[model samples]
Target chain A: MIDWSSFAYLAAAVLFILGIKGLGSAKTAGTGNVLAATGMLLAIVATLYLTRVVQLELILGGIVIGALIGSLLAKKIEMTAMPEMVALLNGFGGAASALVGISEYLSRQGETTGGMVSIAIVLSLLIGSLTFTGSLIAFGKLQGLLSSQPVTYPAQQVVNALILSAGLGLGVLLATSPFSELYLVLLLSVALLLGILAVLPIGGGDMPVVISLLNSYSGLAACATGFVLGNAGLVISGSLVGASGLILTKQMCEGMNRSLLNVLFSAFGKHVESKGADTANKTARSFTPEDAAIIFSNAETCVMVPGYGLAVAQAQHAAQELATVLEERGVKVSYAIHPVAGRMPGHMNVLLAEANVPYEQLVEMDDINPEFPETDVALVIGANDVVNPSARTDEDSPIYGMPLLDVDFARNVFVIKRSMNPGFAGVQNPLFFNENTMMIFGDAKNVLLELVTSIKES
Target chain B: MLDDPAVALTILVLALFVGVEIISKVPTLLHTPLMSGSNAISGITIVGALLAAGGEERNLAAWLGFVAIILATINVVGGFAVTHRMLAMFKGKEQR
Candidate 1:
């Protein structure tokens, strides 16, 4: 029976591998998710039927409570809040793994525990505590509960290193003397502090990397827990998650022209004086939704550029509505998505997807840049940094040399924004003052909705 | 089970490669779902949580185990649920 269950675990692991492999394409993504879920269920059932008789009530009670709350959260979370939700849930997972380590240590009170098990317990406590606190900090930053400014003390790097070293030293001590309960407590405390310190210096713009890295840590924590139990399945899945998180972290760092170390240490998005050309004498031309609508009605080709402002205004649905109205009037519309346009990687894609915007219509920056000159109108919605042309022309600009959408190359441009404020990077945008540009300043959702109505009436 | 550290290490290394290989091929468009999906897999630690909670004696360990079970369960249930919800919303050019 034990052998059979182990075989089932092996099969479940393969299913997980296949599932993730299938996620590489749009056509197979839905099936990939389902396959992974099925693997989870199978693994759970097999674990229940193992030789160790699980207490029926406790197991059922835990599952029921978890499922109820989990389902509620899944159903109620807005798409804009997905990053925060993922961070929060990852924290819970990390905490659970740490608790398992503690519980296992306590359970083996008088027994002569294996050296391997003792070492695994200590490592689990370190990584799990780190993941829990780090993920919580990431969640807070994403949710606007904590300041996006990098909060740091004097010699911050030194303090972080000391805390980390102390935690590892305690791990070594606990491994040598497994019965020393106080060592375990001290180790957990130090590791928790390490997590907070490690993440506190990361500013709002660097959240994607921090979140991805914490996700990797959570997987490592679980892998350590698997070591404590000598479970092959846990080790496999945990390592997989760890690697995937690292890859995503690397991708996010590259997209924003920030290195992993830079993201971890920098306090971005805080107040910074602009270094670009001063436009004190310049003024932006303003237009109403109705005027923008008339212009849109005459355009043959339109491109939508979405940014974090789009998410903040929850304008994805309205943007989609406007696109449909324009498409019906014989205007060709496509969306231009900058890799880092929103809060996270692929943020714009996810928002547009939530609005049922067809994936085929979403053109990435490189693919759409060449088409801008031929385009009749480019709609800039709640976006700034991605469309800012200063990145190409102004050498003194903070965001110079960063790749951007060539929206200014279009024959006509209309921007839906709140004011003449600079973007998150605090760089003034030259595109807004271009001769062909008109700012339809308002909440993105309201303006898009009005544009849809106005365009239809025209 | 405790005697096979080499086997466990081998599985860990192999899984790490498989993960990097498969995910590196995944397009940027599916990155969000990929993160959330891998998150659900991380809940595999729930197996250990189950054994600890269901063990004999109502000791401190058992109570802690109960809490562990709850958290891991939430990770598994919530991660998969949210991933599914998100994936269902991703439509192709013709579907919409």
Candidate 2:
């Protein structure tokens, strides 16, 4: 038998720990990435050393092909699609763990203490299946293949609750019974169905939380598979992933001014058709591009807030161009990024960064919120939820308690949207109707380009 | 002694806390790149599964190994493809 590669594995695990630590701080994130890559390299090499019956040709080929594909992907994908990318990666991890569990189960069917191994295998299978299906649904929504609006039926919450309970009940039975394989398959099917049903009713507004929660589930499945395989490293790394995913999910919940249970059960803001009607009825003043350009052209300082609509219109470059012109005319320009802006977390940052916006100019919600009142203009692009006044003024608003941009306090506010339609959360934005706010109803890219020209002509 | 489930559980719990705390503190600016980078790390599980499956001589083990290798490979390849497409969204455009 090959010697255990314990020392190398330990070193790799340490590297992972350090990498994760480094990732927390922006300044050291690059270093953390390097460390994690090194750890992975070390782990792979050590595993090779421990393999007595190695198929060198196959392994080498796989590595080369995987590396080439990975590098190409890294070079090409746009930042706006990062959330879908993340969801896809989570699915990949789940698939990997599940496959490993299944292989181990099949190999050791007769020899192992069947109870524990079977339990681990079943758990892995269930969680992995759920993660895979749930993540795909999230990807479809984020990519706009599926409707972003919540698909709700009467008694939807009750139906979901029953499904969840039944899935859990089946999981428990699979764990205890001797006829484990039959129950295992049942559990997997139930979990898959549960995943689809769980995410189906979730509105676009709650997708970030769904994605985070699914990520956690994938990690836990990996951890269980690690136990079954008797791999310490897998268990550790998997648990780390699972735990972090849960915490991130919680943070997302808090960011949306929601509780975890409420997100899961209440399906908050899933069908706010009535709320949309209320917002439409509110009389809001409008401004032509020319009239808005005059205010923008004269402003001493301006802060632009880009949202999902801006991305949908592919207007970041246009916005950047407008900012450049405004700056040349002596206006201080910056971008405010809410933590939960866009579909996924940090959605606006990725979009702005793509447009070559400087990292320093991308201010956080807290940093820029206080500065809005003193600013000359707060230009909102394809953004609604992050700027909604309901977070502060209306306690009954579904988005109440969520922190928001203080654009309402600005001397002048320009909102660029297709219409007065409610945002992802399906809530009316009172700011649109404010006297200081002017609606610029058009595609963000076209409107921004028009404003740039009008500013130049004036 | 090291195989004790309790020890495993403790390690799992501690690792998770540390990991979550670290990821949560990452600034908004780095969230995208970091997520993409870490995805590569997750892919390493493929290598582990490969070793476990191929090295064993038994029939069950060999087939298990084969399946593991195939699935893991798909996961790894597909993950990179999607990530690359996502990162491409950031090209061009310089701020003044």
Candidate 3:
């Protein structure tokens, strides 16, 4: 029966891999998710059936309670809050990994442990503890409970290095003395503290990278626990997730034109007052939604660039409506997505998808940049940094070399913003002052609604 | 199922390359779902949790395992559900 269940796990692992393969295309992504869920069901059932030798009630109770809470959370969270929700869940996954390591260690205390087993346990505990707290801090910053700015102190990196060294030293101690659970507890504390300090200096705008990195950590923690348990399914799935996360983290950094080290250490966007007053003196032509509608009506082709502000204002549906109206009026409409446009990679796509925006119309940054010059009107909504021209020209500017959406090259540009205040990086956008740019000052949703109305009327 | 640590290490390493190869091609359109889906899969640690909690010992191991099961279950369930919801909204023109 154990052998039979092992075969089931092997089959489950194959299905999990196929599930991720299904995500390769939008067409099959739904089926892939279902396949993965089926694999999960199989794995869980195999575990339960392998050991009917005892505590059924506790297992059932835990699943029921967990299912209720999990489903409720999934049902209740808004699409705009998805990033933070994912961050929070990642934290729990890491915690579970650490708990498994501890449980396994306590269960096997009477037996002599192998060197490999001891190393796996300590590594799992260390990675799990760090991931748990690191993800929590990410959630806090994303949810606005903590300051979104990079919180840095003198010699922050040096302190972080010393703490990590101390945690590794504790790992050595814990590994040598497996019976001393005290070493385990001390190592866990060091790791949790390390998670906080590691994430502390990362500004909120850089959360895409942090979240992706923590996502990787959670997976590696699971992998370490797999080694402790001698389970191939856990190891396989954990490595897949770890790889997926590392890839996404790299993607996010490339989107911002920064290295992983720079993202982690430099605390980019540390100051908010970097010549922001330049925007006040520079001429930004302000226009009303009605006036903006006239130019949009004349446009033959339009590109919509959305940002995190659009999510904050909950205007995706309105933006969709505006695009629909434009399409109805014989104007071709497509959305130009900046890779790091919203709070996370592909955030704009999620928000837009939620509003039933056609997936084909969401163009990638590299794919859409060349089309801007040929485009008639480009509408910038609730976005700033991704579309800024300074990333191309201003050498001294922090965002000097990052790729932009190139919305400035369009025949006409309409920027829907609340004020002339600088972006998250506190860099003034030359695109805002472009002769072709019209800054429409208002709340994003309100301005979008007004645009939809006036476009309908026109 | 191999009990050898070397076997597990080999599996982990091979899976890392396979994982990277499989996911490297995912288009940005579904990146959110890709992330959420992979996150849910990380809850595979639940197998170990079940083993520790399965015995009627009701000791420290059982309690910790019970707690671990619940937390991992949240990740597995919440992650998949959220991802499904997000994916459902991503309509292509053909679907509409």
Candidate 4:
């Protein structure tokens, strides 16, 4: 006999690898998802049959209840809310790992636990608790339940450092004396508080990095749990997540020209208001919808740049509508995507994808920056900082040295914004006051609708 | 039978390499799906949760196990469903 249960887990591990490979491409991502889910099903089934730990009725009930809630949330959540949803799931993964560690400890009940086992339990508990609470704070920021700006006060770093040192002391004490559950409880509580304190100082603009880091923490928690459980499948999948998430976090930080340490510790976005005072002398030229339409009618090529504003206005469909109109008029249309645009990585891509914009029409910043000079109009919608020339020209600007789209290079630029307000980065845009740039003030959806109408009439 | 730390460590080290290698060349557009997909995989803790829940008899261990099972199940099921929903929305240049 093949001992099908062990074989099933081996098979599941292979499927997970295949699933991750599939997800690397946009084309195969759906199939990749299915493969991973099939693997999960296999692993779950194998565990249920082989362990026979709890009654089948209890297992079935838990699965049914969990799956029902999961399905409802999956179907109901808007695509724009995907980042927070991922954060919430990451939190749950952490909680599961910690809970399993706790249960295992209670079950052991002084079974002569070795030093290695003690170390694994403490690691699982520490990482899991931190990930759980850290992810919740991330979810709160993304979902608007908490302030998206970095929350800091005097001596914040000193206070956090003290808490972390105390946490480590407790962790060490628990590992050395496994029978004393008091240290374990204290460690868990301190870890929870530490997670909250660590994430609270990071602003919403750095959310993608925060989310990725939390996802990695959850994986590391699971990996520690695997060590305690002596399970190969958990070890493999957990490390895979841990490595991939850390890489993604690094990539996002590099995209913003920021170091990971700076993003986590320094209050990056909170210093924007002080920088806003410099914009007082700058004045932007205002244009009407008809004027924008006239310019678009004569344009040979136009690139639309979207940001959080497009998402806030729910104007992705209108953006697509504008693109279609311009294309019908023999004008070429494409999108310029900033990596950190909107609340998360690839947020604008998701919004445009939702509106059914063809994938080829969406261009990354590096590929499209050179295309700007030849372009007739760079239509900036609800975006300010990413297109600001200050990133390259002004040395004292907070966004200095960050790579930005050269939207000002276009022959004519039309910026659609709600007001003269500075962007999320709190820096005033010198590009807004550039002679080539024209500002159209209104909600992006309304302005885009007018642009589509006037272009059609022309 | 797989209790050897050396064995588990080997798998962990290898899986980390495979993870980085597999995700090396993704376009910026797919980053969200990448995050969600990896999230679903992390839910593998459900295996440990199931063992904890069923391995004990009407004790604190059993209750902790049950809660772990519920949380892990949500991560697996919800993570996959959300990833699929987002991936399905991505259209190629040829699509209408």
lDDT of 4 by residue, B1-96 (tens): 356767766788888898888877667788888788889889999888888777647678777878888888889999999889889989897766
Ranking by TM-score: 3, 4, 1, 2
Off by over 4 Å in 3: A51-53, A275-281, B1-3
- Which window of ten consecutive residues has the lowest lDDT sum in model 2 chain A? A272-281
Indicate the residue-level lDDT of A144 in model 3. 94
Over A64-103, each residue of candidate 2 has an lDDT whose tens digit, in order, gives 6555655555456566677886777677667666666656
TM-score against truth, every candidate: 0.95, 0.89, 0.97, 0.97
Off by over 4 Å in 2: A1-4, A25-27, A52-76, A112-118, A153-180, A274-282, B57-67, B70-96
- Residue pairs in steric clash, candidate 4? A53-B54, A53-B55, A54-B54
Q: Where does candidate 1 stray beyond 4 Å? A: A110-114, A393-395, B2-4
Give the least accurate 10-residue stretch of model 1 chain A, judged by summed lDDT: A1-10
Model 3: per-residue Cα lDDT over A95-148, one tens digit each: 999999988888778676547788889989999989999999999999999998
True contacts kept of each: 0.79, 0.36, 0.81, 0.82
Give the higher-lDDT candidate: 1 or 3: 3
User: What C-alpha lDDT, on a 0 to 100 scale, does residue A326 get in candidate 3?
Assistant: 94
Candidate lDDT scores, in order, read: 0.85, 0.72, 0.89, 0.86
